[model samples]
Target chain A: MLLEMLQSLPQVLIDGLALGAVYAVVALGYTMVYGILQLINFAHGEIFMTGAFIGTTFFILLMGMGWVSSVPQIFVLILVLIVTACLTGLLGMGIERVAYRPLRNAPRLIPLITAIGISFILQDVIRFIAELSSGNYIVTGPSLFTDQMTISFSSLSSIFNDASFKTSFLIVLVTAFILMISLDYFINRTKWGTAMRAVALDRETASLMSINVNKTISITFFIGSALGGATGVLFAVQYGTIDPFIGFILGMKAFIAAVLGGIGNIRGAMLGGILLGLLEMFASANLTLLTGGIFGAEYKDVFAFSILILVLIFKPEGLLGKPTAEKV
Target chain B: MPILEVNNIETYYGGIQALKGISVYVNKGEIVTLIGSNGAGKSTTLKSISGLAKVKTGSILFKGKETMNKPVHETCLLGMAHVPEGRKIFSTLTVKENLLMGAFSVNNKQLIEERMEIVFGHFPILKKRLEQKGGTMSGGEQQMLAIGRALMMEPELLMLDEPSMGLAPIIVEQIFDIIKKLNQNGITILLVEQNAYQALNIAHRGYVIRNGEIVLSGKGSELIENIEIRDAYLA
Candidate 1:
């Protein structure tokens, strides 16, 4: 049984890392927005979903225009990522301006509820647009990098089965890492990033330092939503089929990853995302063996949520979260 | 002409008026202090000038620019830096980062470093602990950090709200000395304080505010000697 588990480990880890990469980038959006606003932006998931739909639509349009054949697929992916990021960034900013800004001083619950309302609106709007344009809500774009690849290490393949993955996995992983590293640098090293930290700490004081608080918040929304959207594009490329509902489940998972890592800390979100992904994959691969066949891979979400409950019970602040004092 | 001129400004919080027709002015190279007890709109007046507190009516002129209703950040661009009540230090940030935040309006790194040198001159302890977190420092050090942060802007008019609040007497003296030295170096100061005696001692001119109105204005020394002033504040 142990040998059997080991046989599957290589595949699980590879798949886990790719999924974790997706979760980590999406979780960043959740963590960053939560850190600054102290409001859980439920619309974020829909933003991710919207990105997937937009990316697939763009791919179809590009192919229709015969642009895909002329340019490198990687450049097309990059273009889609940029365009989708900007569109979703603007969407996130508009949500903040139209929905959250007026209710800034309102009770905290109002914004949370509004976020949910916005997500519902986005989901329905995407569904409506998809139905109108394509006569179906499910979208699958032209395969760019679906070539299968094998990994062989003479020393390692002897102990474990050789891992195999699609080229799209590499694309997703590379794009996510680049985005993550850039975001980390932007948050910690850049003036605007440090300024965001200041605004998170104290908005009034940040403004006194000549940092425009409203603009900073708007930028935060922009960056967060942009990352989510780009990750969504990467997600579509990795897994062929997508729908408006995909963001909801994937977003929930990423959010869980954020919580697991420590919601407000940037690096924590990354760690949490990758960790959650690997854990989910591990559970899915071995749940039957671990549970004497009582539970199977289908119960992966149950396993994932159980960990969240356990984490909440044992370490409420999460793996890297600083225990903030209770505030009224 | 005075570097800063506040003409009968009215400011409100919620539905209540905090400053009602309060006027104050600071000439170039003078230490001007606003002394008042708690809830006397001292902070609000400074807030009004710095664009932190909304002024419902009246005009604030900073270096000949009418800036009563400008954005808080634009006020900083107008060469006005306000160190708000309670030191308002970004305690989680390092002292260097805190000072860097002060230089937010200035883009040139060399100019920022030059301004930082001036700040270091004012507070050597700050330069020594450049990497230390602002909150981990003592109250006096945090206050110094706050002032040093504001000085990064190299403002023409520096407004401080309660710099002396919640500090040991000796630390308070050190802060007041810095204020005086800053004034001597041609930075006009607008000081708001609950510690009327200390404020008056270093002030070239003083305004005594009561219930959001400036009830008395005179030379600091003269106000310090007035009988009614002594009875209401000094005593």
Candidate 2:
């Protein structure tokens, strides 16, 4: 029994990594926007869902129009996914301009309430559209990435019999890693990135430094919303499902991930998400085995929140967060 | 003609009035100071000029243009900078990063590099701690960094509020010395201080405010010798 459990390590680790990538991607949107705005874009979950719906609509429309006859031309799917994400990102900007801009100087609660309202409106709009076309509330998403490439060490291939799972998991891992590194470079090395960081630190001082504070904020929202859109597309591809309300749960999980990593710390969100994912998987798997089916896999979310609460009590700044001290 | 002019500016915070028609001016290259008690609106005058706080009724002219209603960043772009009371440096950022942020609007990298060198020349301590986080610095060091950061903007008129607010006597003297050097180098300054004696000593001209109104204005030496100023503010 012990040897079998030891043998299961790689597969379990791989499963955690793939899940973690999704959480990290979604969490980046939460972290980046929060870093600059200092307001939780509560509407962010709806933005993610909007991206998934737009991608699904694009895929369905393309298929209906007979855009591509060959199965190998699936690369077009990625293009559609990107376009959908971009559209949803623009929608996010529009919401900011219309609903949030006027209240920029108002109390923090005002924006938070407005964001919650916007979140509901987005969900209703998507659900209404879904109901009009199809009786079902759920949106049907197609599988665009069907082709798989497997990695094998001949001796270990027998032990890891499921080659397809490993291939797909590797793809998810590589894509997330590349995106995270690119975002890190974009924030630290670029001129605009530093400007954003400056604004985040001290708005009044940053303005006196001649930085266009409003423009920097708008750009931050755009980038964050764009990343959320991309995450939605990747999520649909990974899970083979898309729904209008998908962002609700994912957004909460991502927000929890951001808090667990350190709310305002950029790199912390990524680390926190991965760690949370592993902890969640281990809790469900190990608990089932140890407790003899008394506790089920659905309790993973409970485990994730328990860890979050523990971290909050012990290290509120998160693992890699810098403790801030006010200048008197 | 003055590079910046403020005439009868009244400002308020809800029901309380901070400034009641107070006026001050900055010429092409002269250090001016506003000296008063704690709640006498010395900082409010600077805040109003920088657009951090709005003026209810006033006419402010910068380079012969009206700037009373401009946003903080817009005023900054037009060559005005304010070193706020607390030396609000980006603590999480490095000393170099803080300096770089000061040049955010200037796209000229060459000019920024030139300015950075000048700032480093002015505050060698900042140059030594270029990679250090700003929050770790002592109060005196942060004050130097704040002034150096403002200098990076190359403002035509630099306004400082309470630069000596929380510093030791020696550090205060050093800061005032830097202000004198900066003024001699042709950067027009508007210095506001609760330390009336030190401000008057370094300033070319001074205004004494009480209850948000300017009760006296003249050459710094003349204000220093005034009986009422000596009794109320200098003491």
Candidate 1 accuracy as lDDT: 0.89
lDDT of 1 by residue, B70-153 (tens): 889888987888998998888677899899999997899999999899899999999999998787888899899999999998
Separate DockQ for every predicted complex: 0.55, 0.73
lDDT of 2 by residue, A1-328 (tens): 4444444555556677777877787788788877887788888888888877777777777766664645443465567656866787788778878998899889999998999899999999989998788886686676656666544423474444332363446656776777788888988888788888888887877888878888888887777787777777767666767778888988888888888899878898899889887777766656566557787887788877898899989998887776776767
lDDT of 1 at A9: 89
Q: Cα deviation of B37 in candidate 2 (Å)? A: 1.3
Off by over 4 Å in 1: A325-328
List TM-scores for all candidates, in order.
0.96, 0.94
Candidate number of the best TM-score: 1
Judge candidate 2 at residue B103 and give its lDDT: 86
At residue A134, candidate 1 shows an lDDT of 86
